[model samples]
Target: MILANVTLSGCTGANSALCAGAGEGHLGGGSYRTSLTPTGNLIVAVCLGFIGTFGLTNNLLVLMLFCRYKMLRSPINLLLINISISDLLVCVLGTPFSFAASTQGRWLIGERGCMWYGFANSLFGIVSLISLAVLSYERYSTMMAPTEADSSNYYKVYLGIALSWVYSLVWTLPPLFGWSHYGPEGPGTTCSVDWTTRTANNISYIICLFVFCLVVPFLVIVFCYGKLLCAIRQVREINASVSRKREQHVLLMVMVMVICYLFCWLPYGIMALLATFGPPELVTPEASIIPSVLAKTSTVINPVIYVFMNKQFYSCFHALMCCETPRRGSSLKSSSKAIRAVTGPRRSNDFLFMVASLGQPAATVPQLGPSFEPTIDITKGPSSDINNPVVVSLVAHYDG
Candidate 1:
């Protein structure tokens, strides 16, 4: 009879709860079964699968590049490495469970599983945000005050990474400490923070997360980057030769990364805030699903951005993957030629002449001076010249 119902539900595009609750229906209310539908489960599976696969592959590529290339192992790249590691965790551990819950439309993994999933997801997300803030500050210091930027020591980088982990723990630890609970919601049966059941606790937690993770970090990044841009502009005005094109490229890259970050996570933040403070009727299943998907989307987009927008990262990744050696001789010659080409024929004459001279081999010539060996007695204080024979040795003898 249950098999018949499962088949019928599949045919009607019914919720996944039909299959998900087959064995675990004893734990929750029978009403939970209504949330399961075949169509919804399929959607969850497809979305999560796509996100998990792409995010994992991209982050893995980045990790390989960082490990293989010594040049890419800067302090800034370290932060990126940390971010990729966290994102990869989400892709491998968090997203698969989420997909399963969505398809099942019931808490098949149960209460324990829900808490673990939530903690992992929240931990990685928070870490990624903190890393972004660290990267912004690092760039600002390097560009605005090069001397002050000398503080980017090994200990300092380790400290920043430690702080990121601490921040993640602060947000993730609350639910486990009895401040919140997780459960199934909507027609998808996916588990999340039980905002509807424990409104105040959920509100408090989400507000804290927003303040620490989003609001404060966003402010820090914007302020630092803004000051950096202004400082660069000032230098450019003082001397036209002080062109900061490299710094500008980095700033643009950071801006694009932050903008993408905002797009991916903002909707989730808005939804969380609304669920907490807005009218209860606004927390519809359909509405909640939008943010859930957006949050997952954020994890997937970061790897793509890192791979495509970061030139150094892309080059390093290509070298690692393709096993291609960097061309030294050709690159140097080409670069010199380019400079000459840009500086016109007059400048090219001197530079090309230099290049030609460097291509010739060196030859050793014989010495042109006569040589004579010299001898000295222990008691002698001076010696005569061999060529002139005018000078005579002077000796002092002492009686013992």
Candidate 2:
């Protein structure tokens, strides 16, 4: 069986059946250059460069916003920070490498490097996917049971962040264990799971990956969002128009998220499945690229949906870029007061008495008694009589 290394220039030659001709090529590691047409190389490179740059810049901005502002320091924002980190890793580790490889029109990273690229790319992608699901659940928690969500027990969020990486490692590491392996796939220009291999182990690996990474996460997002919508509908006392508007707004956001997610991933998932399980010649290298680029473009789309959509986030980002204080910072406002209107007087506030009459002379009113009656002096009669009890105030009650 011939292991193929084909030139993309549409040529055939003696050195390689896939090579079209022999010529001096761009100086790579060695002098060997064959006829691989750089037909769409520049376009692919430009697009990839745009994606990498756009994703890197925006994701970094998101990370910075989350880190620099204390007001953003909530459980939901913490989850967002995890997401930003994952996407930044993708931009740093995967996107640039992929862009470079696409520019060269070949897999310049070679065999072992191919494995690393595939593994790291898959790892970050999985992490981002899981993070999105977690973000949705976090939103649902905040919207559905805000009091519980607000309470200080951040261990769950931290544990979730930790587990995302661990779960990614669980799937991506099996390649090293030889159950499934990474190698150059479509066009020999890129590397990924060796889909052409039809062994039981390879098939099993793909099945598990699809199930865990794609199916499970998809279901989690769906369930969380469904519950969120239901909770929104069940909310009482809100005006019908206001509730519908809220429901629609949330629905739009959810739809955008889900649609973009499927837009980026569905094609690739379908293509990968077809390439792995179908006839050997059914899917071609060039055809496989559509999904790859689409999937990587996800790094560009996520920040838009997650950050730019939020007006406050946009304001914070704008403030941050201008080297000014964050106008919409996360820090607690100093103007807030912990005012508890207790019925009984404490020594700290003993001097702050509620005087109800002007006829009262220089005298200290008696302290609160049973029923929280604040002893008042209505008239300047005998001090003892006046102190007996002038008037009692009614306690106020609030109801939702």
Candidate 3:
């Protein structure tokens, strides 16, 4: 709800001038303060402009790649696509408003616009976070139980995606209904869940939002990736053929996952907590805006880490960029040939090892051959005849 505009009392000079627009009420009972100079706001506007442009373009490319390639439409990738969709929505619905606001040095949109921005961003951000956690769990589970990981279980992934959106919506809706509120945040140019509000209504929501949406998802990603690393270690122990370089590569990937999760979210979470509970003025507008800026970086970072890093997706992206439409069939044939080369006589056992090492499939592994039995014993280890059909086809569904 739009609050009544009170005459500026405490703010002086530029803050007073910037807040002096017609019909502009200090969102959340006139709590917002602008410390950023006009030039500072312009810099922020430029940053957000770049973020929005790159974020929109990159995510759109991901969606386009998914749409253009039937091979890319695996169950695991569906979760990745869900993340891209959320990030894309953020770019479209959330970033533009903030960009425009920064250009003006204050929020141009009113209180309702603030609420919508806060709700939409929170909802989409939570969806992206939850989807990452779910994707990690899916990867871990698929690796653990190769037999059960098949195309028939696509419904489970769809269910996970639906549940992520529902879960995010549950958290984001409370603010709209007054469990908390949305209002102008740092520099008065952006709006978010009312972080500066020091009331039971707002603090409780911030705590819950921090713990569940940010902390919990981060923990899940860590736990899942840690388990994946442990599994890779076990494979290394069972088979000496696994090189230390491969182990290092797996470790690096895990580090990247953890680092990316932290890079995108930890600062934002810290700032929110500080704003909610820290001493007065501890989270200055300038300091608070840094985290908010860092948070926006996730929209660009997520797709690069989660989707573009995949081998199959990269190949399709390369084809798309080069306009190799006619060569698409030959490329698939080459992919098949490459799969056979990797799965060939001398190093068949290495196939499963490679999957475990890389934490994903190198290429789309084909389904079980007609002549091959579906059953394979994991007890025999990576060197088992399991590589014949079971492991190969099982890991096929492990696409990102």
How high is the CA lDDT of each candidate model? Answer: 0.56, 0.62, 0.69
Better of 1 and 3 by TM-score: 3
Stretches of model 3 off by over 4 angstroms after superposition = 1-34, 146-148, 243-245, 325-400
Write down the TM-score of every candidate: 0.69, 0.73, 0.78
lDDT of 1 by residue, 1-400 (tens): 0111123334222334343553344345332342434676677678778988888888888887767666666566677788899999988878887676666655456546655776777788889888878867765655433122332356667778889999888877887776765445444344455555435776677678778888888888888667655644543453334234534654686688679877877877777677667765566655566567677776678767754455566555555567886332211111001101111122222221111111112211122233311111111001111121111111122222
| TM-score winner between candidates 2 and 3 | 3
lDDT of 2 by residue, 186-238 (tens): 55445577665677988899889988998888889989788766654543123
Among residues 3 or more apart in sequence or in different chains, the pairs in candidate 2 whose N, CA or C atoms overlap within 3 Å are 9-37, 11-20, 12-20, 71-330, 71-331
| Candidate 2 lowest-lDDT run of ten | 333-342
lDDT of 1 at 49: 81
lDDT of 3: 0.69
Query: Which run of 10 residues does model 3 get worst, by summed lDDT?
Result: 333-342
